[model samples]
Target chain A: MHIVVCIKQVPDSAQIRVHPVTNTIMRQGVPAIVNPYDLYSLEEALRLKDRYGGRVTVLSMGPPQAETALRKAISFGADEAILVTDRAFAGSDTLATSYALASAIRQIEKDIPVDLVFAGKQTIDGDTAQVGPGIAKRLDMRLLTYISKIRELDALHGTITVERRAEGGVQVLKTKLPCLVTVLEGTNEMRFATMNNMFRAARYPLKVWNKESAGIEDLTKIGLKGSPTIVSKVFAPSPKAVKAEIIDTESNQPKDLVVTLLAKLFTKKPDLAHDIAKNAP
Target chain B: MSETTEPRKPARKKVELDPKLARYKGVWVFVEHERGQVHPVSWELMGEGRKLADKLGVELAGVVMGAPGEDTRTFCHQAMHHGADLCYLIADEVLRDYRNEPFTKGMTDLVNTWQPEILLIGATTLGRDLAGSVATTLKTGLTADCTELAIDMENRSLAATRPTFGGSLLCTIVTLNYRPQMATVRPRVMAMPKRDESRTGRIVEHPLGMIETAIITKVLEYIPDNLQGKPQLAFADIIVSGGRGMKKQENFQRIWDLAKVLGAEVGATRPIVQAGWVEADRQVGQSGKTVRPKLYIAAGISGAIQHRVGMEDSDVIIAINSDPNAPIFDFATYGIVGNAMVIVPALTDAFRQHLSTSRMAG
Candidate 1:
């Protein structure tokens, strides 16, 4: 079984800061890590490989620097890493990105038939959660998303069953192989890299593919040309008209603050006090 | 690679869309329903879609696909009451429960036959799963989790505004030349339109062309979430949420203590949820639940734009953080700069006593 996990290199969103004066993203110091959500998928893939005795290939699409992310995946026991990077791939939206990645996966399938594909539920940067399904549709694969648990994998019968999180219930779904699964976050803890695996990752030669190498035949279906969505405007959200009213007291004691806060809140919005009381246990 | 030019920077250039795409004429909202209950996000999208439709001088329509039953028909009427000028109803057994195969086929076929200039869907799990597949099958552009949707009059396209880079910045996206300019808006992002019981509209019936035999995937079982007593943060009127500054898991109990006293739901920031201090369902943020409660008391939250977007619409925001410079104070209605550990308990006690005293007086 060849399980290909799609990962992304994104700026550590938690650490990203916006320049106060300019209101522009301060990307200079932001470190790029493998999209945190993708780690769960990668870990799940690694576990599957350990059990099934097959190869776990990690795939990513980004700039050249994305190689570091794939190497990190390698250190965590991914058998192979492929980076699909190209200048033409810049400004690719979810649709264009999925098209390019699907083409690359098809290319990978030429060497080894892929039985299953894994992807993060969503990327932190885009937060779209569309690319996984887009890839599944492009590849004509069964798309299983928000999977909480992979209950069974029947290689002999060529099927898999998993628990998928829906709105208010968990749906136990059984589907054919050659399917794509996007695992929910916190599905499993990512394993720490071993020293020997770290050495292997450091020395491992990575496969770097541009558009042509990734088997992207249609030029229009890549990068800016292929992207139908255009950013008409980018701006910062306007701050609220009023700043918060700081509740101050003589002693600056917690009790004093609470008393002032409650008094002020009730005096101004009496309805709120009534509402709270109505809901009180 | 060179930096990509901003699409707006080329303001002087004229964009000629494909003539074939120009024929798409109406606005469609996919009304998602499950077990006879329609998701509220569907109504929210319908409300947004009405404005877009009126702006575009087109009819607003809802697309409802499910089993051929009273429930499907009931959803159509609800859609009309919620501002849809018409609803495209596709009823079939295969679509009773959402199976990607038949539903995607039904949606894409409807789009192909009766081309809509714009399509809106709720950004729920079911809608996202369907929209992505349908958009791909049709090769159309789809923007997800849009906070704002409007019509750009120049070329008459859908402008989808959403938080980017984890909510630090907002970007307006437009599907310049794609027919059925598709977008998904999360629940609570848009105001719920007041329903008109007397409102009426047209219902166009469509058929699901596929059968269950053709579908590869099967739903083995559905274990309903035992939500008898779970956090319903999305609809909670009063929410008391904790953040990273809560220190640790033990400290989270204080948040619950306050919530219990006030009958407020307990919420957590994404970090706290990720750290296993709270369930993911209790998380309130850009990636979690978007809540617009009457009062939101945030303790120890630094108010990153992510967590801010989810709760910013609350009628009143009370931020409690030790750091005076915490961003939460910037927009909160009331700011208390003190250790959340102390302030949370004090607030709980104060509210408990205050409410009891008020009850006696009344």
Candidate 2:
């Protein structure tokens, strides 16, 4: 069985801060790391490899620096790593992105048939959750998203069973192989790289594919020219007209502050106190 | 994914749209229904779609796809009450459970038969699953989790606004030349419209030309999420949320105590939830639940844009954080720059005593 997992390198959004005066992202010290959600899918793929004894290949599309993410995946037990990068792929939206990644996967299929594909439910930077489905549609693969668990995998029969997270329930679904599964976050804990594997990751040579090597012949379909959506404006959210009223007291004790807060709060919105009293146990 | 930060090309004289695409008209909101009830986000989109339709001098229509039954019919009427002038109904047994294949086929076929310029859908689990496939199959642009939707009259395009960089900034996106501009808005991002039972509209039934045998994926079973004891954060009247500043997993009990006294729901930031201090359902942020409770008390949360977008619309917000410079203060109704560990307990005690006194007095 051959399982291909798609991953991405994204700036740590948690550390990203907005400039107060400029209203722009302060990207100075924001470190780039593997997209957190992808780690779950990669870990799931590794577990399947451990059980089924199949080769797990990790793929990514980004700048040259993204090779670090691919190497990190190798350290986590993936048998191979591939990175597809080019200037022409810049400014691509989800549509263009899936096109590039799907094209790359198709190229990879030339050497060995891919039985299953795994991707994160969504990327932190994009948050679209469209690329996985887009790739599935383009490749004519069965799309299973928000998968919480793989109940069964019958490689001989080319069938798979999984639990999918829906709006109000979990759907137990069965489908034929050559399917794309977008793993839900918190589904599994990512394994830490062993010291020996870390050494291998440092020296491993990654297969870097340009647009053409990835089988993307149409320039218009891989970059800004191929993107259908255009961003017109970017700005900061306007602050509320009235800034919060700072509550202060002479004692500055928690008890005194609460007492004063309730008094002022009830005075301003008298009905709130009554409502709270009526609702409380 | 399209993070085009480069300055947009200067606006030119109104450019003429493609003749084929120009034929597209009306605004369509996919009416998402489950368990015989339409999701509230569908109504919210209908309300939002109505404004855009009126602005463009077109009609607003709701697209309903589900089992052929009375329940589906009721949803169409509900859509009308919410503001749809008409509804396109595709009722079939194959679409009963939202298997992506049949639903995508039904929606794409409908778009082809009756072209609509703008397509809006709720950004729920089902909606996202369907919208992505439909948009890709149709080769159109789709913007997800849009906070604002409008018509750019200059070019007759749909201007969809959404947050980027993990909610650090907002960007307005436009589908310049796509025949059917597509976008999804998260539940509660838009206000629900007032419903008028007196309102009714025409329902156009269409055939879903697919059979069960043709579908490859099979739903063996569906385990309904047991809601016997779950956090109903989205609909809570009052919410008490904690952040990392609570310091440890044990500190979450203080939040629960305050919530119990006030008969409020418990909420936590993404970090706290990720730390397993609380269940995923209790998370309140851009990626979690979008809540608009009447009273929201946030302790220790720094009010990142990701968390702010989720609850900024609460009727009254009280923020308790150690840092005076925390972003929560900029928009909170009342700010207390102090230790949340101490203040949370004090507030809980104060509210408990005050409510009991009021009960006795009344």
Candidate 3:
């Protein structure tokens, strides 16, 4: 019944600004936060640990500052925290990332058998949604992604029933334990850290691992070298050829504006006019 | 087939396609159909696929997998008119309901057997679900929610451009070593190519070796969503979107009121969508819908690259945030820096006054 939740510390994309000169993200003053989506996964893992009376360990991979993210997870009531920070691990893609995470999990399993692993459905920064499955593939663990609800878990039988989100509807699938689960947002609410747990999180001695400590055997497979996919370049989206045609109404009348806008829009695309008239009350 | 980064273009080296890559042939657009009808996004992908095929000098093919019926065949033919050079049909009774196991098996079978260098799928809820599983099963890389795709003249690499940094920046990804460069494009990002009814393509049919009872997932019931009150922002002619500029959850009511008057659907930024103030489907941002509403009224929304990626395609972008410095004003045609709560209600009343009178006068 022991659980592990993986979280990442990402630049608050909301507040991130690009340097005009460098054309790179300005991170000096940017505040980092645990990915918003990871909260649901962490909370779900904490809930299962609470119900099953087991321990939960939170793990993060980033710069040394990522220790704060691990501490934040502990404050949220995870029993233990681990930080896998290494210079070599930087610039890793989803493929290399899954390798590092899976290696760390295997190391953890050597000490204590992990019954379940939890991760966010996808990272906002990457949005690849590949790490979870990649980790599952490497670790040979069953993957249940975009899970909305955990209907039941039978510890004795090592079986779990969960509802997975498909394209149009929910897929109620039952699978075995020692697997990985990626939780979707709105699945559960995150709880505020109590005064007591906040103190514990502040004091929690984090276990930091580097390339050697993480049990990464192949130097080639743990970072950029291990990554098969590469980001060739980044640039701004090209603007549209023609600028938007503004609907002008000299009358300064709100009704005049809305009507004029519609008239102009439908005049160019007459089928749109039929749709609007049909949907009108 | 050639893998040579020919030093030619200033932007970057040409994608080097190996001469051995000649074995990889045909363009495949994964036809994402469900229920009784195929999703329109499939047709959109087909249109884009035709261009990629034309560049590679290969036949454009559509891979349609669904339950056994005429609908699956009908979709294959429809795909051809949309510019497919061929259709790869895999229909079975078990395929009727969309299941990961059966659908993944069917697709991977066609891919491993036929060897397509490029695979495209619509970035629908179903598309992401199916693409993830198929890519994993095939051990191929998939770039999701691509905003652009191009062929490298040198290496013949399928250069996939997508919004990154939560849509703040755009990054181009290339699957260098992988055979089939798999990608999923969101709906509306690509223009629907002209459909030619006179166009024809070869049809290749394959059998779904499995039966219905063998599939693990059973479609017990489909609770049809009540269509009366759903936001049809994707198909709407005018979308009056709101954001944090509305300030509070309750203030969105004014935006809704204005939208109702203009016969428009309401849209919001990602933060608003994440806040549970609006449905995720109605969210307008990089991670949400790529909208092309005729008239986009962005109330209280400060335009970020993530939010801009979704609504930048609109015919008209009218921004109404309290701060003129808000990025929304930069590209917006009509910028009104005022309280959305106040401005939205005023606009709502104004539209009602204007539209109602115009209806009578006309």
Best by DockQ: 2
lDDT of 2: 0.91
Instruction: Determine the backbone clash count of candidate 2.
Output: 0
lDDT digits (tens) for residues A217-264 of candidate 1: 999988887887778777888888898999999999999999999999
Off by over 4 Å in 3: A20-22, A239-273, B1-11, B14-22, B92-94, B207-228, B248-250, B274-276, B321-326, B333-346, B357-362
lDDT of 3 by residue, B1-362 (tens): 00011111233554445766658887799988766777878888988898899999988899998876789888888998999888999978778766566887799899988899999999875676567667766766678789888987677778888887777667787777667888889888887788799988788998778776565444544444456877777767889888887778887888888777777888988889878899987988877788887778898888888889988878768777667567776677666555667667766775566456656775
Output the better candidate (2/3) by TM-score.
2
Estimate every model's Cα lDDT from 0 to 1: 0.90, 0.91, 0.78
lDDT of 1 by residue, B1-362 (tens): 00122445553246677999989999999999887799999998889889999998899999999998899989999999999989999989888777777888999999999999998888888888998898889888888889888877888878788888888888888887788899999999898999998999989998777878899999999898998888898888999999988998998899999999999999999889888888888999887899999999999999999999999999899999999988888899999999999999999999999999999999
Which ten contiguous residues of candidate 1 chain B have the minimum total lDDT?
A: B1-10
Clash pairs, model 2 backbone: none
DockQ of each: 0.63, 0.70, 0.32
Candidate 1, superposed: residue stretches over 4 Å from native: A249-253, B1-8, B11-14
Quality class of the docking in candidate 3, CAPRI style = acceptable
Clash counts for the predictions, in order: 0, 0, 18
Please give the distance, in angstroms, between residue B189's alpha carbon in candidate 3 and its true position after superposition.
2.0
Ranked by DockQ, top first: 2, 1, 3
Off by over 4 Å in 2: A250-252, A264-279, B10-13
Candidates' TM-scores? Answer: 0.96, 0.97, 0.88
Compared with the true structure, what per-residue lDDT tens digits does model 2 show for residues B1-362? Answer: 38555535642347688999999999999999877778989999999999999999999999999999899999999999999999999999988887888999999999999999999999998899999999899989999999999888998899899989888899888888787999999998899899999988999999999999999999999898998878889878889999988999998899999999998889999999989999999999887899988789999999989999999998899999999999899999998899999999999999999898987898
